[model samples]
Target: MNDGWISDEEERTPQVTPVYSQTFGRGGGRGRGGYGENRRARGFNSRGNSWRDEGNSGGNTQRDGGNIGGNTWRDGGNSGGNIWRNEGNSGGNTWRDEGNSGGNTWRDGGNSGGNSWRNGDENITTLAVKKNNVGRIIGKGGSKIRDLESESGARIQIGKPSDEDYGMTVEVTLTGSEDCRQTAKRLIEELTDDSAPRSYGGNSNSGNSYNVEEPQEEKPRYIDFAEANRAYEEAQKERWAQLPPLKKNFYIEDPAVAAMLPEEVANFRKVNNNITASYALGQSPENSPIPNPVQTFEQCFSEYPEILTQIYNQSFTKPSPIQSQAWPILLKGLDLIGVAQTGTGKTLAFLLPGLIHTDLQPIPRSQRGGPNVLVLAPTRELALQIEKEVKKYNYRDIKSVCIYGGGSRRDQVNIVKQGVEIIIATPGRLNDLVQAGVIKVASVTYLILDEADRMLDMGFEPQIRKSLLDIRPDRQTVMTSATWPEGVRRLAQSYMKNPIQVYVGSLDLAAVHSVTQRIEMIHEDDKIARLFEFLHDMQPDDKVIVFVGKKARADDISSELSLNGVSCQSIHGDREQCDREQALKDLETGDVRILVATDVASRGLDIMDVTHIFNVDFPRNIEEYVHRVGRTGRAGKTGEAISLFTREDWSQAHELIVILEEANQEVPHELYDMSQRFSAWKEKKNEDRGQGRGGGRGRGGGRGGGRPRW
Candidate 1:
C-alpha cells in the first residue's frame, strides 16, 4: 500500500491503480467451471474482484470453478500454486496479497469479494485561507467556527502562524468522512466568495475573476399610521391616569364678579403689556371678574386689610399688568393660569391672593397637620424666593415654612409640626415628606405651581400628580409660567376647574420689550475673549448675570472672571443651598457685581437692578432663551441682553431671529442668514419625510439615508 498526499486544490483526479497484484506464475488453460483464461483486472468492480500476475507459470487454477466464494483456494500445477483467504467480513481492510506459487498472506478479515473501503475512518482536508478573512471566519471568540462545526459535523482546526515569506494565508484543517469534508469545503468556498473585494466601476485584476454585483438602492421604511396613533393614545391614557383627580363635591357656589368695562380692559392692554392672542379661558364664567388697572397696592388690596398695611410699610405703590389681572380672578375663588414675562411680579400676584384667601378661612391650630396653602416650585432657589415673598407680606401671625431637597429634612419636619399656615417646596422634597407622613396636604386649600412648564420639562409630572392627590379636592390652584405650552394646558384641564388664563403680553413667546437683545455669531474659541471685552466695558457698580449652559461651565467662567479682578459669584444646581443663597445675596447687595448661573436662575429670580445679562452659552430652547433674558430688565428698567452664538447654535437661529424681530431689536446679518438656511433645511427635511410616507424616493427618503435633521 502506498501513502497518498492530499492537495489544497478543491478538485483533483485520482491516480492510484484499483487492482490487487500477485507475484506468481501465470495460469495456462481456461476451466470450464468459471475461471477465465489470461484475464487481467482493469479496476475493482462492485464485487471487489481484481487480479494481476508477475512470474511465468503453467496450468491455471480456478476458485470454486465458477464464482469467487469465501475462503476458497486454487492450486495451479508445476509452480506449487498456493492461495489463502479470510472470510471475517469486516468492512475496512488493506490487501497485500503476495503469491510465489508458495502461499498468500491475508491481514484483517473482511468479505472475500466485497468493497472494503469504509467511510468510518477519519479523513482530513486542509484549505489555505487569506489572513484578512480569518477573523471573519472565526467570528467573535470562535462563535462562527463552533456554528460551522455543528452544522457540518466536522472538527475544524486553524493552523498557527508561519514565518515563511510567502503569501499571507492561514491553514484551516477539516477532519471528517468524505461527505463531511465536502460539505465544510463548500461552506468555506461560499464564505470566501462573499468576502472577496470587487471594484464598483473599475476593471478587475488580470489574474483574478471578480464577482461584481450592482448595489441595490434601499427603500424608505414607512411607519404604520394606525399603529403609531394607537401607541400615542395608549401613552396619553397612562399620563392621564397619573394626573390628579377633579373635585367630586366641589362646585362654584358664587359666580365670578362682572367683567370690567371695555375701556378698562383696553387700558390694561397698553403697549408692552398686550395680551397674547392664543390665550384661552377654559370653562370661565361669562362675567368673570376683570380688575381695573391700579397704580397703587391699596386699590388691589380690598380683600385683606392687613395686606394693605404691609404693602404701605414695604412702599408697594403699583401693580404690574399680571398682578392687576390675576388679582381679580384669584380673589374670586377661581382657578387661574397666568402667563407673563419673567420678572413681572408674578410671585406676588399669586402670593397676595393666596394669603388673602388663607385669611378668609383660617385652619384652626388644633386641627392643623399641614399648611393651608402648598406652593410647588421647580427649583430650591425659586421655592426659597417664594417663601421670602410670603414673609414680606407681614405674615408674622400667619406662619409659613419652606421645604426643599438638599436641606435638613428634620428641620422641615419640625417646622411642619409647629402648625404653619403655608408651605413652599419643590415637588421632589414635598413628595418625599408626603410619602413619609411627615407632611400632609389634606387640609391644604390653595396650591400654586410656579414655573409649571419647567417642572413638567424636568420630568416632575408624576411627582406633581402624586403630591396633588394628597391635597383637598376643592383646592384653589394657580399655575404661573413664562410660557404656556400644551402640557400646561393639559395640566389645567386635568386639575383646575374653569381656570381663567391671563396673558400679560403677546403669547408668541418673545423676549421682553424692556430688554435690548444683541446676538453675535462668534466661534467658541473666541467666546472667552469676547466675554472679557464686555467685562471691560461694564462698570464696577453695574449688576450683571452671565448665563452658561452647564454647571461646570458656570464654575469655569466664574473662576476666570474672578481671577481677572472681577467680583464674580457662581451658582448652579449642584451648589449647596446656603452657598447658593449667599451667592444670590452677594449679587443683590452689590457685594458681587457679576453673578454666573445656569438656567436654575432663569425663572422666579428677583434680583433687583440687574443692568445686563450675558448669555455666554445659549439656552436649549426658545422659551428658555426668553426666560434667561427676562432675568434682567426688571421693574420697568431698560436693560441689555447679549448672547454669543456659535455653529452649534444653528438649530436655534430661526427662533433667535424671531425673538429679536419681535422685540424690535436689530438682528445681525450672520444670524439672519443662518436662520434662513436652517429654515430651508427644515423645509426640505419635512418634504423628504412626507415623500417617504408616500413611498416616493428622494435625496433622504431611503432607509438611514442621511444625517439626522437635528
Candidate 2:
C-alpha cells in the first residue's frame, strides 16, 4: 500500500451492514502530471449484477479460492467468480493498478433498496465496471462483497480474464424470479445515480475506450422554463387581444403543460434525492444514507496554522467542501480527484495542505528548484486568481507568482529567480518556461491541476504530459475541476496513484443552485434591441456582466452599447493588457457595470458582488457556463444568470443541462425535455443574433496592445 493509504481502523461495528464500497480511487506519488479534478478511469469489477456510476460512485476488486480452475488473481478481477481471497506466495499477486485518473473517495451515496428479489426468470442484466476498481469492491477478508450480496439479495458476480488475456471482463449472471429482477435493476440503476454515463473521446479518431453517443445535436431546440412560460403567455395574450378584455383560459395549445408535469406527482421523489437529511440516499438502521460529516476551516487551521499564515495573513474566510474533505487526505499525501462546481473554493482544498506540508517539512535551503509546491491552472485568468489568493495567504514569508501567456516572458523569468515558495501557472506558459530552462520543477513535492477537465478540453494534454507529469514521477498530487470528462479522467488515471475522490454540490443540477436563472429569447434580428431593453430595464446600481461569443463582438457590442448611452466596456484578447486590467478594475470599482467579453472572463476570476450575469451569447461549454455564473453569487450572496439564446443555440443549452445535471443542480421540470433536443434547432438560431466577428480579438481574450515588459 505505498504507505500513503489510510489503513482501516481495527474496530468494526458489530452486526455491520455491507456497503457497496466504490472509490474514486486516488493516492499517487509526489510531483506527477496526475493532479486536478475527479475523473474515473479503469475500475475493478466483481461478483453478481453490480455497476458503478457517475462521479460519486467508486469501485474495487479482489479474488481467491473458487477461481475458474486455476491460479490466484490481482488487479482487474479473478479468472472465474471467486476473487484471489487468500494471500498467496506468487510474489504477492501483481496489483493491476488503475491509470492515474484519480482515486476514489467515499461519499456514502445511499443504501440499495435491499437485495432485489430476482426470480430465476429470463430477466438478464449487464453490470459493467471499470477494470481497475475490483479490489475496493471486494476489499480484504471477502467480507465487503458478502455484505453487498447479503444486503442486496442479488447474486453479485465479478469476472476477469486469465493472465493470457489482455482485456478484463466482469459478468453478473442472474437467474431469479421477476420480483428479484425488478429489485436488482433498481439497485443497479442507483449506483451511478448523480453521474451520467462516462464517454471517452479519441485522439484524431484513434478510438476511445469509453463511449456514450456524443450528446446528440439535439434538434427542436431548448428553451428555459421562463422562456417556455413567456411563449405561453405571449400566445395567450394574442388570443386575449382578440377577445373581450376580461376573457381568459383560451384553451392551452402549448404541449409543454402536459410535458412538464411532475413525474408521479408526489411518489417518493422517485430517482431524485428528496431525503437529504442523511449523508447520501437510502436509509438503514446500520447504514445511514448520507455521511454528513463536517470539516470546518478553523479545524484545518488549528492543525496547520503555519501553513495558513504562510499563504495568507488571515485564515480562509470559509471552509468549502473541498477544504473540508481534502485537509485530511492531502495532509496524509493521498492522491485525490475532487469534483465540484466552479468557485466553490476547490483551490484552497488542496493548496492549504500543500502549503502546510511545506511549512512542516520546510524544504531546506539549497534543495533544488525553489519551492516544495506547484499549482497549475488551465487559464491565465485562473492561474492569476490562484496566485492572488495565495499571495494573500502567504502573509509575510512565503512567496509565489502567477505565470501565464501574453505577459512578458522576461518578467516571468525574473520572478523565477526570486526563489518563489509556490508557483501558480498555466500549462502553456509554465511549459514554455520549463523548456526554456528558466525554471526547474524537480524539487517540487506537491503538484495540483485546477480545472483539469477544461485544461484538456482546451488542448493542454500534451503540455501536461511534458511539464506537469514529467516534473516528478513520485509526488503527492491533487487535481480539481468543475466537470469530470472522460479525457480528463484518462489523463488523471495515467498520472495519479491510489487517490481519493471528492465531489461537492451534486445535489442539484448546478453548483450554486441558489442562483436564479432566466432566459430571454428575442428574434434573432431583434436581439440587439432586446439586450438594450434589458439594460434599460436594469437598475443603475446593479453589477452586470454581458458575455459574447467572440472578442471582437465584445468590443463591437461595448461600442454599440455605449453609443446607445449605456455605460459599458469590453475585455477581450485584443484589448491592451493594460486596458484589460483597466476594464476589470473599472468593473470592480463600479465605473463600468456592464463588462463585455468572451470565455476569457469565464473562469476562476472572482470579481465579487456581481448582481447579474448576461449571457449575451450562449456559452461554448458547460464548464464555461459554471465559470461565468461563478463570477456572481459569490461570498455568500444571491445572484442571477440571464442567458440569451436563439433557436440555434439549443445544443449549447443542452450541454448546459448535462453539465448542470452532473453537478446535481435541478433544471425546472419544463426545461428538461427541451434541453435534450437543443442542437440543430438552436444551431440556425444563432443567425437570428450576432455579437460581432469583426476585426480583432486578443489572446487574453483579444490581443490588446501594451508595451512588452521585456
Instruction: Return the TM-score for each candidate structure.
Output: 0.62, 0.52
Error of 1 at 294 (Å): 5.0
Candidate 2: residue 249 lDDT (0-100):
14
Worst 10 residues of 2 by lDDT: 244-253
> Which clashing pairs does model 1 show?
34-65, 89-111, 276-507
- lDDT tens readout by residue for model 2, 24-43: 43533222112221222222
Model 1 weakest lDDT span, ten residues long = 2-11
lDDT of 1 by residue, 566-611 (tens): 7789999999988999999999988998999999998888888999
* Quality of model 2 by C-alpha lDDT: 0.57
Residue 552 C-alpha lDDT in model 2: 77
Error of 1 at 235 (Å): 29
